[model samples]
Target: MNIKQPDWEAIERAYRAGALSIRTIAERNGISDTAIRKKAKAAGWERDLSEQVRKEVRNKLVRGEVREDQCANPERDAEIIEEAAEEGATVVRSHRRDIRKATNLANLLMDDLLNTIQRREEIEDEIERETAGDESGFRRSSMLAAVALPSNAKTLFQLSSAMKNLQVLERTAFGLDEKEKSADADELSSLIDELSKDA
Candidate 1:
């Protein structure tokens, strides 16, 4: 029986290109899977090229690539801008998306004021829920239980930090959109009002 010497360069290229599995490469080369894998590694057959090479390839591909719409040259850049503007007006139509947009007010600034109104209402409803829970006398016991019975100060600090963060978020959101005259702002205002009751 005769076993011919494997074409090392071809095997390395196949491995580098991911055209052949390690097991398949081993079978073709008449070597164990481990040996084939080790040879591929030793020969500098990279599975993931260096970050610089990857970045270069990305830049090259992006520069070379063209979108289908971009090739449709009759569509002017102004038309694209106008379409984006039209879409932006109604982007926050849904209550959820409105609140989401309002939370990150920078994105929602171009959105219609109605979105901010709707988002404020959602905030108000959540505030009411919390207020009701607090009124039921269950909140104090629960708060105390969680804080007093916690295993360590870390847990208490985490809860305190979370509550403080929520306060900051509400304040920031309020600062961004001062149009509390809108329905959305009503809820947000109520939440801010309620949270700041002690203040």
Candidate 2:
């Protein structure tokens, strides 16, 4: 009986490519699986498979000759899966950050609108009190003139318009309608809750 020497170079190439099982490579090269395993371990070739290798493995699996378990280093395959999952998670986190930023800006706009309205009301009240007092006609005219300024009215109108637009945007972003304002608010609250929970 005659035995052939193991082709170490060919075995290393097949193992590094990660497309074939040690058993398959051994059979193809007319060597024992144990010999290939020992040579691969000695050469420190235990890493994740390349894309080409994975593709080859898929083809082999499709042909129904090789089972998934027959592939080299199941742990390396699992690590690859874990890395892909983490990449997906990072994308989700980025989207969440963008949503929170927009929400925060909307909240700030709402605060500004509330403060402006309050100030406008306070000014109107002061004007009414001055009109009721025994002030001179000249002073009363000046007070009314301030109230009737075009710029002041325009500013209030613009602020109100901005508030309305922001409200519309919030509703649109949250998949709600004008009539569902409360639902939009609730959705935002729930989103915040979700974000906090993730934190």
Candidate 3:
């Protein structure tokens, strides 16, 4: 029997995206539930239906459709209630971890942005000093304009425009455009020759 290997990453992503059931994931992937469960355990994936159930209960309660006591069966659903509570705690911890990771990433990006701004300012000052005696003022003004920071809205707009332009350039460069055109042999040869000259 040829056993197909499951894509563990895909399975894990699906699980994280709220699939949350070993049997459900296994059935979807045509794998054994035990295999899925093992992989999830190894990946430290948490399953929490309590949060979802709580939200649903809250909504229903607000609409006067269900009472608080009806949320769980005290006798028959004791084990399920305990499991949900434990999983709910796990979910809260997981969310806190995710928030920390996001905060760290934001800090790192902010540092990089500040460094870039500082470097740009240093370069501008150097250029200004160099062009101080030029008398033309054209070079200084042009360089300053080139490095000028835009207002928040303008910055967002410029970034969006730049991203679109980059996407277009990439498509054309990689011959992934609708025309599916690539560089001719002569162009390719010329590029190779130019690169070889640098060597």
Task: Pick the lDDT winner.
Answer: 2
Regions of candidate 3 where Cα sits further than 4 Å from its true position: 1-68, 124-199
For residues 1-199, could you state the per-residue lDDT of candidate 2 as single tens digits?
A: 8776777766665555443456666777988889887877888865344342333323332332222364465655544433433333343455546666766775676576566555866876787786776556777667756555464567567756765775665554443562422223223324433543455
Q: Write the per-residue lDDT of candidate 1 for residues 1-199, one digit (tens) a residue.
A: 9878778865654444332345655776787879777886787655321122222222332343212242232233223323322322232123234445445653343243335344654644555566574657566445334323242345445545655654565544333433324223224224423433423
Q: Model 2 — which ten-residue stretch has the worst lDDT?
A: 180-189
| Pairs clashing within candidate 1 | 117-184, 120-184, 124-187
Tell how far residue 126 is off in model 3, in angstroms. 7.0
TM-score, cand. 3 vs. native:
0.32
Error of 2 at 180 (Å): 26
Which of candidates 2 and 3 reaches a greater TM-score?
Answer: 3
Residue 28 of candidate 3: its Cα lDDT? 71
Any runs in candidate 1 off by more than 4 Å, and if so which?
48-199
- Cα displacement (Å) at residue 187, model 2: 25
Cα-based lDDT at residue 76, candidate 3: 28
